[model samples]
Target: MVRQELVARQLAEQITEHFFHGNGAAEARPLRVLDVGCGQATQVVRLARAGHLVTGLDPDPVTLGAAQGAIGAEPQQVQQRISLLTGEGGDCGRWFGPGTFDVVLCHGVLMYMPEAEPMLASLARVLAPGGMLSVVVRNGDALAMRPGCAGDWGGAIEAFGTDRYTNRLGLPTRADRLEPLTRTLSEIVVPLRRWYGVRVFTDQTPDHVGPPVDGRQLAQLLDAEERAGRTDPYRAVAALLHLVGTRPG
Candidate 1:
């Protein structure tokens, strides 16, 4: 889960800075955030602790139950700042009116979707004017990287022609290319703001491999990873893409 934590920390820092550090009306602190498919409410708890009002929605009752348990373990004030619901990504409009949230997060959930445009439209519909939308998805452009690095020549060869692949969980899943998604966001009125690569070099690592035990080494590794995530040609082939969009006010 080290990689997941890294992604979360980076995203949280960016969101906090974008929403809390500016004086303009667009930069509002203590904003309302919606986390779609918020498994276990990891980001929900973090944002709530930072004083943002956060709501987490997940389709799985068990996941929502666990998220509720996590919230219960926090201080009463933090717990009170969060609300949970059992729902799907497309249910955004059904549960909240337009302009309900300043930040809408839909991370690590798009890979399971058969199609992303419809869901993106729904997510955009509920976002407040000038709000930010964050999405994380498998990188279709680099589907061959992992297999190629692992010496699965056949798999690598096949990946080059397809955006479909089996996930770490052994389930068939889809990926998204940066260019196509950028256009899709533009068409939906939430033009791309900024994006970064995630797990650029660690994509092929075994899931059991985690952070180093030494603090210094772990810190240095994370620094390198963060740098590579934002740097040029290196980021282009990352296993995952983190894209942010802004809705015009």
Candidate 2:
């Protein structure tokens, strides 16, 4: 939960800065947002509560039910602003017309797809002109960091030449390299805008360990992580990448 919270908070900050902060039209209007593969709907509810018109889709009924339950806790108006559906990420274009959403989120979803281009193409189809598309994926360039730091030299060594890695769930999964993904985004007509690394130093930290209880210490830790995520050399070796792209007309 702590790690997830960190990622969510960073995403919110970037979205605010890049999409809602300086844009005059977006500032005056409620942006239309879509969250593909929105597991548990925590972030979806957060965005809806912030007054965006949000639609979240996930293939799992249990997760969609959990999201619905979360949305139910909000005020009626906020709940009305949210829509949840049982669907996969690849069906986004089929579910919505082109240029339907101003901001599209597909965090933690691409890693599961053996081939990501189809889903990327679908996501691009739904984004409006100048719309933002935020993606979060396991970083292929730094795939060996966790295992190498944990002293799994062999596993870390093997990770260097391939994008395949076993996740904490012990399942075979894929990672995305920044350069290749940047190219794909361009090909899809959504070029990369800004990106940050997630879990730069904390990736090797045990999940059992929680964030600092003291306010000052917690702030300090978060501050350091946030800085490392944006700075060079540090971000170059993070465990995950948070990328933002914009569709240019």
Candidate 3:
């Protein structure tokens, strides 16, 4: 969905702000970033273009090949800033030195893992002290939003109660709430912020709404959603949860 992608971009920008603004940190020191399970490496490429050294790690060779191809197609300056590696998220410590990166990202990858704790622990291990860790996951609570909006209240309730939903591809997927996610990471790092992403209003919109929407309007909607995501009454309906954490300095 366009809205979901917009929301992800908004959250990624927020994570960048948290790293650059809140910490008064220089982008040049320990400037390296790792994008765990970075299929196609879009975020990795974007960060590299912004002058940060980026490494995209994925277990799939096919995906890594695609990421390399994408990077090679970019301008030389941007291409020079990124490297793609084949590796599992939980095995990052073996390939990357501990405390080697200033920012670590594991987005849209954890839901597929049978266990999140080990992967999250590896992420924390690679993060430099005072560095940031950004995570994006499917929202457990939002399982009801689609069904209810589609006029199937009973199905929505049942889905929420069952704690899973089917994607457009008809694959069964699981969601996670903020509480448990925070708790799991807190065991290894300190959480800085928790926010809802792709809030209910945006998630329920059908893909065929119209022609491509204006970026300015999309930005405006994202700004509003970002503000609302941190508060009650709205956070509960978000389709994704974005959490930012930091390794103790």
Candidate 4:
């Protein structure tokens, strides 16, 4: 919840700043948005509800089905704005022409791949000029933070100097450091515009523990995390990195 909320807020801020002249009236203009690896369509549905035309593509049919079910439960108007497809990040080109989407999101999807450039290049090609490409991945530079926080000295030490790690689901995955990722984005012509740290303070929270039930506590927690995600030294060590890039117009 913390990670999702922070990512959504940051993305909204950037999208508004670039496209909506900063006022962020979602109804002002409906942009075409594409969400690759849109697991469960959290962002797809959110953007659709905001009046944007959204296409959610994922390789997993079961996940897409679940997302379809969630979208099905939305109001008729919102449901009308969303389209779900079966595809993967690299498969994006198979379904859309170049410069088709005003916004492209690939969140929590890169870690599954050993490298980032190939998948990133694929997503970038589908982004229209001046479009925003938002990416979220495990922070390779801070790979040790989680284990270190949990007192797993050996795991923490091993996590250093390498992006490969087993996720909470026990799935082997890799992470990305900002420097290399930024360089890759440059090579692909989607230059980095802004980036943020996600789950700065809440990364250590156990996955099973639900969000705070108290409204005030949840707000306070979110505020602290939001502040940390934007601040320097703190954001540098966040467990995840949210990188926003823009295609040259």
**Best by TM-score, which number?**
4
List model 2 lDDT by residue over 15-76, tens digit each. 77766674543464678999998888888887887778999999999988888888888899
Report lDDT per candidate. Answer: 0.87, 0.86, 0.76, 0.92
**TM-score of each candidate structure, all chains considered together:** 0.93, 0.92, 0.84, 0.98
| Top lDDT prediction, candidate number | 4
Between candidates 1 and 3, the one scoring higher on TM-score is 1
Clashes found in each candidate (C-alpha, N, C closer than 3 A): 0, 0, 0, 0
Candidate 3: the clashing residue pairs are none
Lowest summed lDDT window (length 10), candidate 1: 20-29
What is the total number of backbone clashes in candidate 3?
A: 0
Name the regions of candidate 1 deviating beyond 4 angstroms. Answer: 22-28
* lDDT for 42 (candidate 3): 79
lDDT of 2 at 17: 73
Sorted on TM-score, best first, the list reads: 4, 1, 2, 3
Q: Mind giving the per-residue lDDT tens digits that candidate 1 earns over 6-69? A: 6776676667566665353346468899999999998899889878899999999999999999
Lowest summed lDDT across 10 adjacent residues in model 4 is found at 19-28
